[model samples]
Target: MTASTKPYLLRALYEWCLDNNQTPHIVVWVNEHTRVPAQYVRDNEIVLNIGQTASHNLSIDDEWVHFSARFSGVAHDIWIPVGHVISIFGRESGEGMGFEVEPYQPENTDTQADKPQAAADKPAEAAKPKKGLKLVK
Candidate 1:
Protein backbone atom coordinates (compact mmCIF):
# COMPACT_ATOMS: atom_id res chain seq x y z
CA MET A 1 0.00 0.00 0.00
CA THR A 2 1.04 3.60 -0.47
CA ALA A 3 2.03 5.95 2.31
CA SER A 4 -0.65 7.73 4.31
CA THR A 5 -1.51 11.33 3.46
CA LYS A 6 -2.05 12.42 7.06
CA PRO A 7 1.48 13.59 7.71
CA TYR A 8 1.60 15.75 4.60
CA LEU A 9 -1.75 17.33 5.39
CA LEU A 10 -0.67 18.01 8.97
CA ARG A 11 2.45 19.80 7.77
CA ALA A 12 0.45 21.85 5.32
CA LEU A 13 -2.12 22.84 7.94
CA TYR A 14 0.57 23.82 10.39
CA GLU A 15 2.20 26.03 7.80
CA TRP A 16 -1.14 27.49 6.82
CA CYS A 17 -1.98 28.35 10.40
CA LEU A 18 1.36 30.06 10.83
CA ASP A 19 1.04 31.95 7.61
CA ASN A 20 -2.35 33.20 8.70
CA ASN A 21 -0.92 34.48 11.99
CA GLN A 22 -2.73 31.83 14.00
CA THR A 23 -1.20 29.57 16.60
CA PRO A 24 -1.04 25.97 15.54
CA HIS A 25 -2.33 23.36 17.95
CA ILE A 26 -2.55 19.62 17.73
CA VAL A 27 -4.91 17.11 19.30
CA VAL A 28 -3.36 13.77 20.13
CA TRP A 29 -4.77 10.53 21.43
CA VAL A 30 -2.68 9.26 24.31
CA ASN A 31 -1.45 5.71 24.14
CA GLU A 32 1.23 3.66 25.85
CA HIS A 33 3.76 4.73 23.22
CA THR A 34 2.85 8.39 23.26
CA ARG A 35 5.40 10.49 25.18
CA VAL A 36 3.71 13.40 26.85
CA PRO A 37 3.10 14.87 30.28
CA ALA A 38 0.45 12.82 31.99
CA GLN A 39 -0.67 15.62 34.22
CA TYR A 40 -1.65 17.69 31.24
CA VAL A 41 -3.65 14.89 29.65
CA ARG A 42 -7.38 14.69 30.25
CA ASP A 43 -9.80 12.00 29.09
CA ASN A 44 -6.90 10.27 27.33
CA GLU A 45 -6.48 13.19 24.93
CA ILE A 46 -4.19 16.20 24.98
CA VAL A 47 -4.24 19.43 23.07
CA LEU A 48 -0.87 20.99 22.51
CA ASN A 49 -0.04 24.39 21.15
CA ILE A 50 2.88 24.16 18.75
CA GLY A 51 3.52 27.75 17.96
CA GLN A 52 7.14 28.82 17.63
CA THR A 53 7.08 30.55 20.99
CA ALA A 54 5.41 27.63 22.73
CA SER A 55 7.63 24.81 21.60
CA HIS A 56 11.33 24.28 20.93
CA ASN A 57 13.16 21.99 18.55
CA LEU A 58 9.84 21.00 17.04
CA SER A 59 9.93 18.55 14.17
CA ILE A 60 6.90 17.11 12.44
CA ASP A 61 8.08 14.15 10.41
CA ASP A 62 6.40 11.25 8.64
CA GLU A 63 6.53 8.91 11.61
CA TRP A 64 6.36 11.21 14.58
CA VAL A 65 6.21 14.73 15.86
CA HIS A 66 8.92 15.60 18.37
CA PHE A 67 9.22 18.71 20.44
CA SER A 68 10.07 20.20 23.78
CA ALA A 69 7.77 22.44 25.71
CA ARG A 70 7.39 23.70 29.26
CA PHE A 71 4.38 22.72 31.28
CA SER A 72 4.04 24.34 34.68
CA GLY A 73 7.72 25.38 34.48
CA VAL A 74 8.85 21.85 33.74
CA ALA A 75 10.23 21.23 30.30
CA HIS A 76 9.15 18.00 28.68
CA ASP A 77 10.24 16.10 25.61
CA ILE A 78 7.08 15.23 23.71
CA TRP A 79 6.94 12.61 21.00
CA ILE A 80 3.65 11.68 19.37
CA PRO A 81 3.35 8.93 16.82
CA VAL A 82 1.88 10.31 13.62
CA GLY A 83 -0.95 7.84 13.73
CA HIS A 84 -2.08 9.07 17.14
CA VAL A 85 -2.51 12.64 16.05
CA ILE A 86 -6.25 13.25 15.84
CA SER A 87 -6.14 16.75 14.43
CA ILE A 88 -4.16 19.94 13.93
CA PHE A 89 -5.74 23.35 13.98
CA GLY A 90 -5.31 27.01 14.73
CA ARG A 91 -5.67 27.63 18.41
CA GLU A 92 -7.05 31.10 17.82
CA SER A 93 -9.81 30.20 15.36
CA GLY A 94 -10.20 26.45 15.83
CA GLU A 95 -9.87 25.98 12.09
CA GLY A 96 -7.90 22.99 10.89
CA MET A 97 -8.19 19.35 9.98
CA GLY A 98 -9.13 16.18 11.78
CA PHE A 99 -7.81 12.73 10.93
CA GLU A 100 -9.08 9.23 11.43
CA VAL A 101 -7.07 7.10 13.82
CA GLU A 102 -5.33 4.26 12.05
CA PRO A 103 -4.67 1.30 14.29
CA TYR A 104 -1.01 0.46 14.48
CA GLN A 105 -0.20 -3.06 13.46
CA PRO A 106 3.14 -4.26 14.70
CA GLU A 107 5.44 -5.99 12.25
CA ASN A 108 7.13 -8.27 14.78
CA THR A 109 4.43 -9.71 16.94
CA ASP A 110 4.50 -13.33 18.11
CA THR A 111 0.75 -13.81 18.67
CA GLN A 112 -0.25 -14.45 15.10
CA ALA A 113 -1.80 -17.83 15.83
CA ASP A 114 -3.48 -16.60 18.99
CA LYS A 115 -5.28 -13.77 17.22
CA PRO A 116 -8.61 -14.52 15.65
CA GLN A 117 -9.59 -13.43 12.16
CA ALA A 118 -11.09 -9.93 12.27
CA ALA A 119 -14.01 -10.64 9.97
CA ALA A 120 -14.74 -14.03 11.45
CA ASP A 121 -14.62 -12.75 15.01
CA LYS A 122 -17.56 -10.41 14.41
CA PRO A 123 -21.03 -11.88 15.00
CA ALA A 124 -22.87 -12.41 11.72
CA GLU A 125 -26.06 -11.08 13.27
CA ALA A 126 -24.39 -7.74 13.97
CA ALA A 127 -25.11 -6.82 10.37
CA LYS A 128 -28.79 -7.37 9.63
CA PRO A 129 -29.60 -8.50 6.09
CA LYS A 130 -32.03 -6.54 3.97
CA LYS A 131 -35.58 -6.83 5.28
CA GLY A 132 -37.07 -7.66 1.87
CA LEU A 133 -35.75 -9.07 -1.38
CA LYS A 134 -35.66 -6.94 -4.50
CA LEU A 135 -38.08 -7.71 -7.38
CA VAL A 136 -36.60 -9.31 -10.43
CA LYS A 137 -38.26 -9.56 -13.82
Candidate 2:
Protein backbone atom coordinates (compact mmCIF):
# COMPACT_ATOMS: atom_id res chain seq x y z
CA MET A 1 0.00 0.00 0.00
CA THR A 2 1.13 3.52 -0.72
CA ALA A 3 1.16 6.39 1.76
CA SER A 4 -1.31 9.22 1.40
CA THR A 5 -0.04 12.55 0.08
CA LYS A 6 -2.27 14.61 2.32
CA PRO A 7 0.15 14.97 5.19
CA TYR A 8 2.99 16.07 2.94
CA LEU A 9 0.82 18.64 1.28
CA LEU A 10 -0.31 19.93 4.64
CA ARG A 11 3.25 20.36 5.86
CA ALA A 12 4.24 22.07 2.65
CA LEU A 13 1.42 24.54 2.84
CA TYR A 14 2.12 25.19 6.49
CA GLU A 15 5.74 25.99 5.70
CA TRP A 16 4.68 28.19 2.83
CA CYS A 17 2.40 30.14 5.12
CA LEU A 18 5.21 30.68 7.56
CA ASP A 19 7.67 31.67 4.84
CA ASN A 20 5.26 34.30 3.63
CA ASN A 21 4.62 35.63 7.15
CA GLN A 22 1.00 34.51 7.19
CA THR A 23 -0.88 32.71 9.88
CA PRO A 24 -1.90 29.19 9.06
CA HIS A 25 -5.22 27.78 10.14
CA ILE A 26 -6.82 24.42 9.72
CA VAL A 27 -10.44 23.38 9.37
CA VAL A 28 -11.00 20.23 11.33
CA TRP A 29 -13.95 17.89 11.10
CA VAL A 30 -14.66 16.93 14.66
CA ASN A 31 -15.05 13.20 15.12
CA GLU A 32 -14.51 10.50 17.70
CA HIS A 33 -10.81 10.38 16.89
CA THR A 34 -10.44 14.12 17.39
CA ARG A 35 -9.61 15.61 20.78
CA VAL A 36 -10.47 19.29 20.74
CA PRO A 37 -12.49 21.73 22.79
CA ALA A 38 -15.99 20.51 22.06
CA GLN A 39 -17.58 23.66 23.45
CA TYR A 40 -16.04 25.73 20.64
CA VAL A 41 -17.04 23.46 17.80
CA ARG A 42 -19.65 24.80 15.40
CA ASP A 43 -21.51 22.65 12.91
CA ASN A 44 -19.28 19.71 13.85
CA GLU A 45 -16.21 21.61 12.76
CA ILE A 46 -13.54 23.82 14.29
CA VAL A 47 -11.02 26.24 12.86
CA LEU A 48 -7.68 26.08 14.57
CA ASN A 49 -4.85 28.56 14.29
CA ILE A 50 -1.76 26.42 13.79
CA GLY A 51 0.75 29.20 13.45
CA GLN A 52 3.84 29.24 15.66
CA THR A 53 2.45 32.13 17.68
CA ALA A 54 -0.75 30.30 18.53
CA SER A 55 0.27 26.69 18.99
CA HIS A 56 2.82 25.03 21.21
CA ASN A 57 4.61 21.72 20.73
CA LEU A 58 3.06 21.52 17.29
CA SER A 59 3.58 18.38 15.30
CA ILE A 60 2.08 17.39 11.99
CA ASP A 61 2.86 13.79 11.28
CA ASP A 62 1.54 11.21 8.87
CA GLU A 63 -1.28 10.15 11.15
CA TRP A 64 -1.86 12.97 13.59
CA VAL A 65 -1.57 16.69 14.16
CA HIS A 66 -0.89 17.39 17.81
CA PHE A 67 -0.56 20.67 19.64
CA SER A 68 -1.46 22.71 22.69
CA ALA A 69 -3.07 26.10 22.55
CA ARG A 70 -5.00 28.50 24.73
CA PHE A 71 -8.69 28.68 24.24
CA SER A 72 -10.62 31.26 26.27
CA GLY A 73 -7.66 31.68 28.60
CA VAL A 74 -7.44 27.94 29.27
CA ALA A 75 -4.85 25.66 27.77
CA HIS A 76 -6.11 22.70 25.79
CA ASP A 77 -4.23 19.88 24.19
CA ILE A 78 -5.45 19.15 20.70
CA TRP A 79 -5.18 15.82 18.93
CA ILE A 80 -6.46 15.72 15.41
CA PRO A 81 -6.29 12.72 13.13
CA VAL A 82 -4.87 13.68 9.76
CA GLY A 83 -7.83 12.10 8.07
CA HIS A 84 -10.21 14.45 9.84
CA VAL A 85 -8.55 17.62 8.58
CA ILE A 86 -10.90 19.23 6.07
CA SER A 87 -8.58 22.01 4.94
CA ILE A 88 -5.50 24.10 5.74
CA PHE A 89 -5.26 27.68 4.59
CA GLY A 90 -3.48 30.94 5.31
CA ARG A 91 -5.58 33.27 7.45
CA GLU A 92 -4.55 36.26 5.38
CA SER A 93 -4.45 34.99 1.78
CA GLY A 94 -6.68 31.94 2.15
CA GLU A 95 -4.29 29.99 -0.02
CA GLY A 96 -4.09 26.31 0.74
CA MET A 97 -5.65 22.93 0.06
CA GLY A 98 -8.73 21.02 1.11
CA PHE A 99 -9.19 17.31 1.38
CA GLU A 100 -12.17 14.97 1.63
CA VAL A 101 -12.87 13.93 5.19
CA GLU A 102 -12.01 10.32 5.80
CA PRO A 103 -13.95 8.19 8.25
CA TYR A 104 -12.05 6.81 11.21
CA GLN A 105 -11.31 3.12 10.87
CA PRO A 106 -9.58 1.41 13.72
CA GLU A 107 -6.91 -0.96 12.61
CA ASN A 108 -7.60 -4.58 13.51
CA THR A 109 -5.14 -5.83 16.06
CA ASP A 110 -4.65 -8.97 18.01
CA THR A 111 -3.49 -8.06 21.50
CA GLN A 112 -3.62 -4.42 20.39
CA ALA A 113 0.06 -4.06 19.66
CA ASP A 114 1.69 -0.66 20.33
CA LYS A 115 -1.55 0.75 21.76
CA PRO A 116 -1.59 1.72 25.38
CA GLN A 117 -3.24 -0.88 27.61
CA ALA A 118 -5.73 1.63 28.95
CA ALA A 119 -6.66 2.86 25.50
CA ALA A 120 -7.04 -0.66 24.20
CA ASP A 121 -9.36 -1.52 27.04
CA LYS A 122 -11.64 1.45 26.53
CA PRO A 123 -14.72 1.01 24.38
CA ALA A 124 -14.77 2.84 21.06
CA GLU A 125 -18.10 4.45 21.91
CA ALA A 126 -16.51 6.14 24.91
CA ALA A 127 -14.71 8.57 22.65
CA LYS A 128 -17.79 9.62 20.74
CA PRO A 129 -19.29 13.05 21.35
CA LYS A 130 -22.56 13.15 23.21
CA LYS A 131 -25.78 13.40 21.26
CA GLY A 132 -28.30 16.30 21.57
CA LEU A 133 -26.96 18.86 19.17
CA LYS A 134 -28.20 18.77 15.59
CA LEU A 135 -27.28 20.82 12.54
CA VAL A 136 -30.21 22.59 11.00
CA LYS A 137 -30.02 23.12 7.27
Candidate 3:
Protein backbone atom coordinates (compact mmCIF):
# COMPACT_ATOMS: atom_id res chain seq x y z
CA MET A 1 0.00 0.00 0.00
CA THR A 2 1.09 3.55 -0.64
CA ALA A 3 2.20 5.63 2.33
CA SER A 4 -0.22 8.25 3.60
CA THR A 5 0.31 11.93 2.93
CA LYS A 6 -1.46 13.11 6.06
CA PRO A 7 1.67 13.38 8.15
CA TYR A 8 3.49 15.44 5.57
CA LEU A 9 0.54 17.76 5.17
CA LEU A 10 0.26 18.13 8.92
CA ARG A 11 3.91 19.05 9.29
CA ALA A 12 3.76 21.52 6.43
CA LEU A 13 0.68 23.25 7.77
CA TYR A 14 2.22 23.42 11.24
CA GLU A 15 5.24 25.20 9.79
CA TRP A 16 2.98 27.50 7.82
CA CYS A 17 1.05 28.42 10.93
CA LEU A 18 4.23 29.19 12.81
CA ASP A 19 5.59 31.29 9.98
CA ASN A 20 2.34 33.22 9.81
CA ASN A 21 2.36 33.97 13.55
CA GLN A 22 -0.73 31.90 14.16
CA THR A 23 -1.14 29.21 16.76
CA PRO A 24 -1.53 25.75 15.27
CA HIS A 25 -4.09 23.41 16.70
CA ILE A 26 -5.14 19.88 15.86
CA VAL A 27 -8.48 18.14 16.30
CA VAL A 28 -8.04 14.53 17.35
CA TRP A 29 -10.48 11.67 17.51
CA VAL A 30 -10.19 10.11 20.92
CA ASN A 31 -10.05 6.34 21.12
CA GLU A 32 -8.41 3.58 23.18
CA HIS A 33 -5.06 4.24 21.48
CA THR A 34 -5.15 7.94 22.17
CA ARG A 35 -3.39 9.09 25.36
CA VAL A 36 -4.86 12.45 26.27
CA PRO A 37 -6.48 13.96 29.34
CA ALA A 38 -9.97 12.51 29.41
CA GLN A 39 -11.41 15.44 31.28
CA TYR A 40 -10.78 17.81 28.40
CA VAL A 41 -12.32 15.63 25.72
CA ARG A 42 -15.84 16.24 24.49
CA ASP A 43 -17.90 14.14 22.10
CA ASN A 44 -14.95 11.78 21.66
CA GLU A 45 -12.63 14.47 20.42
CA ILE A 46 -10.17 17.10 21.66
CA VAL A 47 -8.63 20.25 20.21
CA LEU A 48 -4.98 20.48 21.09
CA ASN A 49 -2.81 23.57 20.91
CA ILE A 50 0.38 22.36 19.29
CA GLY A 51 2.27 25.57 18.95
CA GLN A 52 5.87 25.84 20.12
CA THR A 53 4.81 27.76 23.23
CA ALA A 54 2.26 25.19 24.30
CA SER A 55 4.03 21.88 23.72
CA HIS A 56 7.51 20.57 24.48
CA ASN A 57 9.44 17.82 22.77
CA LEU A 58 6.77 17.80 20.12
CA SER A 59 7.27 15.25 17.39
CA ILE A 60 4.95 14.32 14.56
CA ASP A 61 5.94 11.10 12.90
CA ASP A 62 4.17 8.81 10.43
CA GLU A 63 2.56 6.72 13.11
CA TRP A 64 2.26 9.02 16.12
CA VAL A 65 2.37 12.48 17.51
CA HIS A 66 4.12 12.89 20.86
CA PHE A 67 4.31 15.92 23.10
CA SER A 68 4.35 17.17 26.66
CA ALA A 69 2.14 19.98 27.82
CA ARG A 70 0.61 21.43 30.94
CA PHE A 71 -3.03 20.89 31.68
CA SER A 72 -4.55 22.59 34.69
CA GLY A 73 -1.02 23.23 35.97
CA VAL A 74 -0.03 19.58 35.67
CA ALA A 75 2.33 18.33 33.01
CA HIS A 76 1.17 15.39 30.99
CA ASP A 77 2.50 13.36 28.11
CA ILE A 78 0.26 13.01 25.07
CA TRP A 79 0.39 10.31 22.43
CA ILE A 80 -1.93 10.31 19.46
CA PRO A 81 -1.92 8.02 16.49
CA VAL A 82 -1.58 10.06 13.33
CA GLY A 83 -4.55 8.33 11.78
CA HIS A 84 -6.79 9.70 14.51
CA VAL A 85 -6.01 13.30 13.73
CA ILE A 86 -9.18 14.70 12.16
CA SER A 87 -7.92 18.15 11.30
CA ILE A 88 -5.20 20.78 11.66
CA PHE A 89 -5.98 24.49 11.71
CA GLY A 90 -4.73 27.83 12.88
CA ARG A 91 -6.33 28.94 16.11
CA GLU A 92 -6.68 32.47 14.86
CA SER A 93 -7.65 32.06 11.22
CA GLY A 94 -9.19 28.64 11.44
CA GLU A 95 -7.68 27.72 8.08
CA GLY A 96 -6.34 24.27 7.39
CA MET A 97 -7.21 20.81 6.20
CA GLY A 98 -9.37 18.05 7.55
CA PHE A 99 -8.94 14.33 6.99
CA GLU A 100 -11.08 11.23 7.39
CA VAL A 101 -10.87 9.69 10.85
CA GLU A 102 -9.59 6.14 10.65
CA PRO A 103 -10.63 3.74 13.36
CA TYR A 104 -7.62 2.24 15.10
CA GLN A 105 -6.92 -1.46 14.81
CA PRO A 106 -3.97 -3.07 16.50
CA GLU A 107 -1.70 -4.91 14.10
CA ASN A 108 -0.78 -7.55 16.65
CA THR A 109 -4.30 -8.90 17.07
CA ASP A 110 -4.14 -12.37 15.56
CA THR A 111 -7.69 -13.54 16.01
CA GLN A 112 -11.27 -12.48 16.63
CA ALA A 113 -10.85 -13.46 20.27
CA ASP A 114 -8.24 -10.75 20.69
CA LYS A 115 -10.59 -8.05 19.36
CA PRO A 116 -13.21 -6.26 21.38
CA GLN A 117 -16.52 -8.10 21.10
CA ALA A 118 -18.52 -4.88 20.86
CA ALA A 119 -16.49 -3.66 17.91
CA ALA A 120 -16.32 -6.99 16.18
CA ASP A 121 -20.04 -7.59 16.47
CA LYS A 122 -21.14 -4.13 15.54
CA PRO A 123 -21.90 -3.13 11.97
CA ALA A 124 -20.18 -0.14 10.48
CA GLU A 125 -22.13 3.08 10.63
CA ALA A 126 -21.89 6.21 8.54
CA ALA A 127 -19.60 8.86 9.88
CA LYS A 128 -21.44 11.42 11.94
CA PRO A 129 -20.97 15.15 11.47
CA LYS A 130 -20.23 15.60 15.12
CA LYS A 131 -17.42 13.07 14.98
CA GLY A 132 -15.65 14.84 12.14
CA LEU A 133 -14.51 18.36 11.34
CA LYS A 134 -16.83 20.99 9.84
CA LEU A 135 -15.95 24.12 7.96
CA VAL A 136 -17.36 27.31 9.37
CA LYS A 137 -17.96 30.50 7.43
Candidate 4:
Protein backbone atom coordinates (compact mmCIF):
# COMPACT_ATOMS: atom_id res chain seq x y z
CA MET A 1 0.00 0.00 0.00
CA THR A 2 1.21 3.49 -0.80
CA ALA A 3 0.49 4.49 2.77
CA SER A 4 2.50 1.65 4.25
CA THR A 5 6.21 1.37 4.96
CA LYS A 6 6.53 -1.21 2.23
CA PRO A 7 8.89 -0.39 -0.61
CA TYR A 8 6.42 0.76 -3.26
CA LEU A 9 8.62 2.16 -5.99
CA LEU A 10 5.67 3.00 -8.27
CA ARG A 11 3.88 4.91 -5.55
CA ALA A 12 7.08 6.78 -4.89
CA LEU A 13 7.10 7.78 -8.54
CA TYR A 14 3.48 8.87 -8.43
CA GLU A 15 4.03 10.73 -5.19
CA TRP A 16 6.88 12.53 -6.85
CA CYS A 17 4.39 13.52 -9.57
CA LEU A 18 1.75 14.67 -7.09
CA ASP A 19 4.23 16.77 -5.14
CA ASN A 20 5.14 18.44 -8.40
CA ASN A 21 1.44 18.70 -9.47
CA GLN A 22 1.94 16.37 -12.38
CA THR A 23 -0.61 13.69 -13.22
CA PRO A 24 0.71 10.14 -13.01
CA HIS A 25 0.02 7.73 -15.85
CA ILE A 26 1.43 4.23 -15.52
CA VAL A 27 1.97 1.22 -17.70
CA VAL A 28 1.31 -1.91 -15.68
CA TRP A 29 3.70 -4.53 -16.91
CA VAL A 30 3.51 -8.32 -17.36
CA ASN A 31 6.10 -11.02 -17.40
CA GLU A 32 7.92 -11.13 -20.73
CA HIS A 33 6.59 -14.66 -21.22
CA THR A 34 2.97 -13.89 -20.47
CA ARG A 35 0.11 -13.12 -22.81
CA VAL A 36 -3.33 -11.73 -21.91
CA PRO A 37 -6.12 -9.74 -23.48
CA ALA A 38 -5.70 -5.96 -23.51
CA GLN A 39 -9.10 -5.32 -21.93
CA TYR A 40 -8.16 -7.53 -18.98
CA VAL A 41 -4.88 -5.70 -18.53
CA ARG A 42 -5.80 -2.03 -19.20
CA ASP A 43 -7.02 -1.17 -15.70
CA ASN A 44 -4.41 -3.43 -14.13
CA GLU A 45 -2.00 -0.52 -14.50
CA ILE A 46 -3.80 2.78 -15.11
CA VAL A 47 -3.03 6.06 -16.81
CA LEU A 48 -4.67 8.25 -14.17
CA ASN A 49 -4.96 11.99 -14.86
CA ILE A 50 -5.91 12.75 -11.22
CA GLY A 51 -8.10 15.75 -12.03
CA GLN A 52 -9.68 17.38 -8.96
CA THR A 53 -11.60 14.40 -7.62
CA ALA A 54 -12.20 14.95 -3.90
CA SER A 55 -10.63 12.28 -1.72
CA HIS A 56 -13.36 9.95 -0.51
CA ASN A 57 -13.97 7.85 2.59
CA LEU A 58 -14.26 4.49 0.89
CA SER A 59 -12.70 1.82 3.06
CA ILE A 60 -9.58 -0.15 2.33
CA ASP A 61 -6.70 -0.85 4.71
CA ASP A 62 -6.42 2.12 7.10
CA GLU A 63 -3.13 3.25 5.62
CA TRP A 64 -4.36 3.05 2.02
CA VAL A 65 -7.34 5.26 2.79
CA HIS A 66 -6.44 8.28 0.68
CA PHE A 67 -7.26 10.04 -2.58
CA SER A 68 -6.41 7.60 -5.33
CA ALA A 69 -6.68 7.14 -9.06
CA ARG A 70 -10.24 6.43 -10.26
CA PHE A 71 -10.66 5.07 -13.74
CA SER A 72 -13.20 3.36 -16.01
CA GLY A 73 -14.33 -0.28 -15.90
CA VAL A 74 -12.68 -2.22 -13.03
CA ALA A 75 -14.84 -3.02 -10.01
CA HIS A 76 -12.80 -0.99 -7.51
CA ASP A 77 -13.71 2.70 -7.61
CA ILE A 78 -10.36 4.24 -6.67
CA TRP A 79 -6.72 3.25 -6.57
CA ILE A 80 -4.46 3.14 -3.47
CA PRO A 81 -1.53 4.90 -5.16
CA VAL A 82 1.57 3.24 -6.55
CA GLY A 83 3.00 2.63 -3.11
CA HIS A 84 -0.05 0.61 -2.18
CA VAL A 85 0.32 -1.28 -5.43
CA ILE A 86 2.42 -4.36 -4.85
CA SER A 87 1.92 -7.13 -7.34
CA ILE A 88 -1.04 -7.02 -9.66
CA PHE A 89 -0.93 -10.45 -11.35
CA GLY A 90 1.64 -12.38 -9.40
CA ARG A 91 4.69 -11.80 -11.55
CA GLU A 92 6.85 -13.38 -8.91
CA SER A 93 5.44 -16.83 -8.19
CA GLY A 94 3.36 -16.79 -11.35
CA GLU A 95 0.78 -18.34 -9.07
CA GLY A 96 0.80 -15.83 -6.29
CA MET A 97 -2.11 -13.64 -5.20
CA GLY A 98 -3.90 -12.14 -8.16
CA PHE A 99 -3.93 -8.75 -6.48
CA GLU A 100 -0.72 -9.03 -4.53
CA VAL A 101 2.11 -6.58 -5.21
CA GLU A 102 5.87 -6.56 -5.65
CA PRO A 103 7.37 -3.32 -6.96
CA TYR A 104 6.90 -0.88 -9.87
CA GLN A 105 9.06 1.14 -12.20
CA PRO A 106 8.24 3.40 -15.09
CA GLU A 107 9.54 2.25 -18.44
CA ASN A 108 12.42 4.60 -19.28
CA THR A 109 12.56 4.79 -23.02
CA ASP A 110 12.47 8.55 -22.45
CA THR A 111 14.40 9.70 -25.51
CA GLN A 112 12.46 7.67 -28.07
CA ALA A 113 9.23 8.12 -26.13
CA ASP A 114 9.41 11.83 -27.03
CA LYS A 115 9.26 11.30 -30.77
CA PRO A 116 5.94 11.98 -32.52
CA GLN A 117 6.02 9.61 -35.46
CA ALA A 118 7.04 6.55 -33.50
CA ALA A 119 4.44 3.84 -32.93
CA ALA A 120 3.04 3.46 -29.44
CA ASP A 121 4.68 0.07 -28.95
CA LYS A 122 7.82 1.38 -30.67
CA PRO A 123 8.65 -2.09 -31.86
CA ALA A 124 12.32 -2.91 -31.49
CA GLU A 125 13.84 -1.99 -34.87
CA ALA A 126 17.54 -2.43 -34.29
CA ALA A 127 18.88 -0.19 -31.46
CA LYS A 128 16.60 2.85 -31.87
CA PRO A 129 14.82 3.09 -28.52
CA LYS A 130 11.12 3.46 -27.83
CA LYS A 131 9.75 6.68 -26.32
CA GLY A 132 8.20 7.59 -22.97
CA LEU A 133 5.43 10.01 -22.01
CA LYS A 134 6.35 12.96 -19.82
CA LEU A 135 3.41 15.08 -18.70
CA VAL A 136 4.31 18.78 -19.06
CA LYS A 137 1.61 20.27 -16.88
* Poorest 10 consecutive residues by lDDT, candidate 2: 128-137
Put down candidate 1 lDDT per residue, 2-101, tens digits, no spaces.
9889989999998999999999999999866467888889998999999999999888777678888999999887877788899999988999999997
lDDT of 1 at 55: 96
- Name model 3 segments beyond 4 Å from true: 109-137
Best by TM-score: 2
**By summed lDDT, which 10 consecutive residues of candidate 4 come out lowest?**
89-98
**lDDT of prediction 2:** 0.80
Better of 1 and 3 by lDDT: 3
Candidate 2 per-residue lDDT over residues 1-137, each given as its tens digit:
99999989999999999999999999999976678888989999999999998999888877778888999999887878788999999999998899999865556433444343433433444333345533222
Off by over 4 Å in 4: 1-8, 30-46, 49-75, 78-137
What is candidate 4's lDDT per residue for 37-86, written digit by digit as tens? Answer: 23545545532233234323322232232333333533333423233343
The lDDT per prediction is 0.75, 0.80, 0.79, 0.35
- lDDT by residue (36-111, candidate 3, tens digit) is 8889999999999999999998888777788889999998778777889999999999999999997766654444
**Would you give me the overall lDDT of model 3?**
0.79
RMSD for all candidates, in order, please. 14.4, 6.8, 10.9, 17.4
Alpha-carbon runs more than 4 Å astray in model 2? 108-137
Clash count for candidate 3 is 0
Q: Estimate each model's TM-score.
A: 0.76, 0.81, 0.78, 0.27
Question: Candidate 1 clashing pairs?
Answer: none
